[model samples]
Structure formats: structure tokens, C-alpha cells
Target: MTDLLMNPTVARLTSRSLLGRKRTLLLSLLPLALLSLCTLARILGSLDDDIAGQLQGSLSADLLSTFGFAIMMPLLGLIAGTGSIGPEIDEGSIVYLLAKPLNRYTIVVTKLLVAIGVVTAFGALPVLAAGVILTGELGEIAVAFAIGAFAAGVGYAAVFLLLAVITRNAVVVGLIYALIWESLVGGLVPGAQTLSIQQWATAIIEKTLGYEAQLLFVESAVDFSTGLLALVGVTLVATAYAGRRLQTIRLHDES
Candidate 1:
């Protein structure tokens, strides 16, 4: 287990999968769009609080909630989470690792760490940079939103990793949850908003910025406590479940 945890080979594999051509391209898209929009917004006029408010409130909020959480987070999670283990499982290459003396749980934990790191870099960091670009450090709103993005990234990675362990269609299911449930239903249905990852994340931002801030840049359907609880609970449960699943996983024949 120690060797597996310390293994450079695992890190190499994780990095390769994460930085692969397709995943890298997809991951770059949203951040590029964000930067471009910020540049365009700046070019149009001087950065005013009113302009910042509209940018941060309407545009930034929409991008973070709709595109960041609903699209980018899940897509990045799907790539990082499933990319960490799915290909190995699909091609029966996992037997190489499983046959070693390492404990299965160690492998799972290592991969989960890699996935979390990847999600943080590709998902959360960009959100932070984008938030700053949109609103500056005004009232620390950018910092607040960044914290929410980081928290959401960790939770999203855990959930998607567990989904990878449970099903081959982890990406599809993740997309459905992120896009359909979080985006479509969570918007129109009042009850569904309480269950949304996007809302939970935004609630963190709302709390950090206060009620007046909530009235402006951030909006959340659920209260702060519920959102924090759900975020922490989902992250812990999904990680634990993924570890347990790894312990019992059976590798398929390559031939």
C-alpha cells in the first residue's frame, strides 16, 4: 500500500490521462471563453461598479452556475474521475496494479487525490481567475466565489469518481445530473434548487458576501448551513464509497 501510494507510475498515469489531448481541449474551452468575455467587457468601457455588478451578478453568476458548475465542473470531473480509473478497467489494464502487493484501497485513494487535484486546477482555479477579472477584489466577492468553486470542485470530483466505479456510463450520467437536473430543473423547480450542487456552491458565496452581496453577485436557493452540510457530506460519502468499491473490484480478462 505504501509503495502504491508513493508510486511515481500512478502519478505518471494520472497526469497522462488528465493532460491527454481531448480532455485538455475540453477543459480549456470554458476558461478561454471567460477570459475572452472579460477582455471584451473591458474593451467596451472603463470598469465601473455598475458594469462590474452586471458582469459579476448576471454574466459571472450565469457562467459559474450554468457553465462552471453545470457544464465545466462535471465535464472536468468526468475526465479526471473516470480518466483516473475507467480506461484501466475497460482495457483490463487494472490487473497489472491489482496483481501487485498493494492494497486496493490505496490505489483508489491515490487516484482520488489525483482526480481532486486535477479538478481543482482545471475547474476551480479558472473560476477564481475569472471571478477576479469580472469583479476585481471588490468586497472580497471574488475570493468568496473562489472558495465556493474550490469546495464544489472537491465534491464534484468525489461524486464523479464514485460514479466511475459504479458504472461505465459515468460521464453520461454526470452530464445528465449537471446539465439536466442542475441546469434545467433546478432553475424552474423551486424544490429541486435545494438539491442542486450549483445552488449549494452559490450559497457559500452568498454567505461570504452577505445579504446585500447575495442580492447582487450571488444568489442561492438553499441556506448556508444546508449547502455546507451537503457539500461536506457528499464529498465524504462519495470518497468512502469509492474506496470501499475499489477493495471489492474484480478485473476483467484482457483477451
Candidate 2:
């Protein structure tokens, strides 16, 4: 666990790179947008009951599911996970590190920690705050979405990190998974829904919230056990495979 959580130098480098200006801007926009929308939701919910009804209906379905889980986590996961190694590979710097006497497993785990750390920070906090504001309540739905977003972020970091290891087009692939597979197909196709991270996270939220939360539109297509199993299994498999793939990764000579 100690070895798995971090390595000082690697963590520092990943943190600096992941939180650089452009990426910082992207991350900042998300939380700001979520919070702003949440605040407006609260005001509107207070002004009139009808608009409040509309906002409440969309709160769980659109804001929590669509924005937080589908959009935020995967996008953050892709940027952090792939950006950890993608730029180094693109500029021919990865060869220097690849030739070093570091354990491949340690390197992979270190990057993963950095990725998951950033994802949790950016993904979970805003969702929790937004859920609370959107509903003007706590515990019932807010806490549930917070935990779901964090879990989904963790699982997403592992999967996208593996994609970074396997392909240069990892970002493009991740977007397709985030948008097309999870968003487009998962809604229309029953088989695809079973494998979706969003649904798994929703299952978590559904189970976490108290019974009174049924009034909210916190719909989930999968069982809690199945969702839990899928999220954990995918994270472990992706991380293990990424470590193995890292061993075989061929760094081109900069010359």
C-alpha cells in the first residue's frame, strides 16, 4: 500500500504537469460551472414551485448523471491519465525515463495515484456541492452522488491510464468511450448499459441514498453488487495489464 500510494519525485512531476496552465483552466471551468448552475438551481427552486419541479427533475438525471459522471470524471480521467505519459512520448522524453532502473509496476502505480488524486479532487467535490445546492438538501442525494463521482473517477483513471499505455490515440479513444459508448449507446442498448461506469456509479448512488430519495430521479439499471464488481474488476484488470504493457513498451531513439 505504501509503495502503491506514491513515489515522491514521480508524484511531483505528474502533479506539476497535470495541473499546468491549460489543464488547470479546464479543471477550473468544470467546478465553477457546476457550482454556478447549482446556485441558480437553488434560487430558481425558491422563486417558484413549478420551475423548482423542473430543476429537481433534471437535477439527478441531467446534472448528476450527465454532467458529473459522464462528462466530468471521464474527461478529467482522460486528461490526467494519458497526459501523464502522452506528452513525454510525443516529445521523445519518455525514452530517458524508460531506460531508467525503475520498476514498471511502481511507475504505473505512481502515475495512477496522481491521476486518481486529481480526478477525485475535481470530480467529487463539485458534484457533492452541486447536488446539495440543486436539491437544497443533504444526505439523501448529495452525499450519494459525491461518493459515486469519486468511485467513478478512481475506476476511470485506471481504465484511461491503461489506454494511454496501449495506444497513442488514448485521448480520442477515451472521448469515444465517454461520449459515444457510455452516452450514446449505453442509453439505447441494454447490453452496453451493463458495462457502463455511469450506470455503476448510479447504482452506488441509488444504494447510498436513503429510501426517501426515491422522489429524485436517481435511476440505475444495474444492481449494486454487479456495479461494484465491475468497477473494481475493471480498475484492477486495467492497472495490471497496463503494468505488463509498460514492460513491453518500445521507446523510440531520439536520435
Candidate 3:
């Protein structure tokens, strides 16, 4: 029996599917846009620390938080997390793996690891590069948002991966959460911000960036400690639940 901890073949397959053809092009959108936006923002404006800090903070909170963390990371997470296993289950090909001696936990965990890695590479890394580009230095603001991006990636990947296991409409659900709740409601309602993944991630940014974060428009709704707990809790609960769901998964014979 192959180790349930990780199967090299599964990892390779996930990597190929995630990075394949149209998906690679899809993943490039955020990085390319971020780079272009930051490059233009930097060039069009003068370079003073005060000005740099203001611009960086504005981009970090207004632009990056709205687009990168709220929209991009979750969408990337939805695509990767759901893409990793959803297609197999839809094709009814997952039954072959389930029929084998592998632990369901192993399958869930391995696929989750791949999805998280994909988000980090495509989502978190680009945000970091964009941060550096906007600020023109590897300063605290750049580093703080990089950390926030990774945290947001972790939260998004776990939740979407669970959605993939539980529902066929994972993408639909993910879009509602990413777009409607985050973009529309969170902006209109104050309390909704407290429960948001984007807000939780900004809590980390608030704590880490210290004084520089004040230049930004919004403060994180939750405290730093609460954000950490919420992030960890969401990740653990989603991953555990997905593994449990995988154990009892019923395959339909659509042939």
C-alpha cells in the first residue's frame, strides 16, 4: 500500500491538471495585472517615503485587499481546490482510487497540499512581488501583506477544498462567498467584516505593519489573536471534514 501521507503520483497529477493549458493562462491574470498596476503607479508618482508609504498602503488595503485577497486568492483557491478533486469525482473516476487500499485521509490531504501550494505560488507570491514593486523596497508593508496573502490563501484553500468534497456546486458557492459576501456586503455592512477571511488576513497585516498600516483606509475588524485562531480553526475544520466526507463518498455509475 502506498503511504497515505502523500502519493507522488497524485501530487504529479494534481500539479499537471492545475498548471495545464487554460488554467496556466488564468493564473497569470492576477500577477500580470498586479505588476502592471504597481509599475504604473510607481512610475507615474514621485518617490518619497511619505508618498511611497501612502501609495503602498493604499494599494495594500484598497486595491490588493479588495482584488488580490478578497477576489483573486479565493478564486485561485476555488479553481485549484475544486479542480484537484472535483473533475475526478464528476467523471466517476475517483471510484478507482477509492476502490484501492489507500486511506481517504491520504487522498484528501495530498490533494489539499497541492491546492494550497498552487495558491501560494500563484496567489501569495504575486501579491508579494506586487508589494515590492509598489513600495520599491522590501519594507515592513511589503512583508506584512505577503504574510497576509499566505494566510488568506490558507483560509481560502481549506474552505474551498471542503466545498469540493461536499458539493458539486462548489464553484458557485465559492463565487458567492468571494464576490457577494466579501465585495458587496462587507463593504455595506460593518459586522460582516468581522466574519470575513479578508478581514482576518488584514488583522495580521494590521499587527505586523504597525504604524504604516494606519495609512490604509480600513482596519481589520477582528483582533490579531482572534484572526489567528479563526484562520487555524477554519483550516483544520475544513480539512478534517473533507477527509471524513471522502471516507463515505458514494460513486454514481453514470456510464
RMSD of 3: 2.6
TM-score for model 2? 0.91
- Per-model RMSD to reference: 3.0, 2.4, 2.6
lDDT of 3 by residue, 1-255 (tens): 556678887788888888898988988787688778777777765645565566756754566776777678778888888888988887788888888787788888889889889888988888888778777778876778889988988888889889978888888998898788866776457889888888888899899978767776558889999989999999989989999999987767343
Better of 1 and 3 by TM-score: 3
Candidates by TM-score, descending order: 2, 3, 1
Candidate 2 residue lDDT tens string, 2-104: 7555677777888898899999888778778878877876797789888788665555446777777777777877877887767776676767777877777
lDDT of 1 by residue, 158-212 (tens): 8888888877777888878767887688766899988877788878988887765
What overall lDDT goes with each candidate model? 0.74, 0.80, 0.81
* Model 3 error, position 81 (Å): 1.1
Question: lDDT score of model 1?
Answer: 0.74
Give the candidate number with the greatest lDDT. Answer: 3
Give the TM-scores of the predictions, in the order they appear.
Answer: 0.86, 0.91, 0.91
Error of 1 at 142 (Å): 1.6
Pick out the ten consecutive residues of candidate 2 with the lowest summed lDDT. Answer: 54-63
